[model samples]
Target: MNTVDALVQLSFQVQRILAEAGAEHDLSIVQLRLLGILRDRQPGMLELGQHLGLDKSSITGLVSRAEKRGLVERSPSPHDGRGVLVALTPAGRRLVEVGEAQINRRITELTKRLNATQRKQFTQLASVLVNT
Candidate 1:
């Protein structure tokens, strides 16, 4: 496959592996990503959209859907009242923590599948990619 197609395939595999498994809770990958981003900062919608590579309207819609689930909230930014800040509610934090652990576990499991030489290559590549 071409590089773009390979990247797309990798993304699909990652989303499928980490996505919520039960009918009781359904969150899209974008929603999950937004939660992760919020875990770091209470970003304004504009900043959040930039982080998520989405438009403001799209981020707003995603936030609206997540808010309905009691997972996230919007408050006035401490630095700017006119600017709304998006943050994870306690439930959202729990969800993100769970997702993080799950992702880490899966990655570890996958990494262990590699032999020693391949494992070194993987780690080296990951460090460079992530640092970049």
Candidate 2:
């Protein structure tokens, strides 16, 4: 019907798909996002917060939880002594690889449900929404 309603429905569907797929990886969406961000290298807490649009407090809490689960670790930054670095462990990297595969599978399933024209339109609409 309306734009908001359509968006709400899409969000619900996306969340449901992600939740179902991500359950096997045992990661929250936020944690998954962080892993995606860290796929290449480690980042400091401030950089992570900025990238995630979260505050220092939120990042600290996430890092704390992740550390407790042995998913991540905090180390002294090679660039700066005062800054701390966040890096994924071997188990964390394995989890991320599995999660990425699962998430991609779910996304492919969602896309397959759309016709080519509808998929194109959805892509354009999503790009516009993100830019706005």
Per-model CA lDDT versus the true structure: 0.81, 0.86
| Each prediction's RMSD to truth | 2.9, 2.3
**Per-residue error (Å), model 1, residue 92:** 0.9
| Tens digits of lDDT, candidate 1, 1-132 | 997897688778766666742212477677778888888888898898998899878988999999999999999888986899988999988888877877787767756778999989977976997798
Question: For each candidate, what TM-score against the reference?
Answer: 0.78, 0.80
lDDT of 2 by residue, 1-132 (tens): 998998899899888877776666677878777888888889999999998989999999988998998888899998998999999988888888888788788887878989999989989989998998
Best by TM-score: 2
For candidate 2, the lDDT comes to 0.86
**Collision pairs in model 1:** none
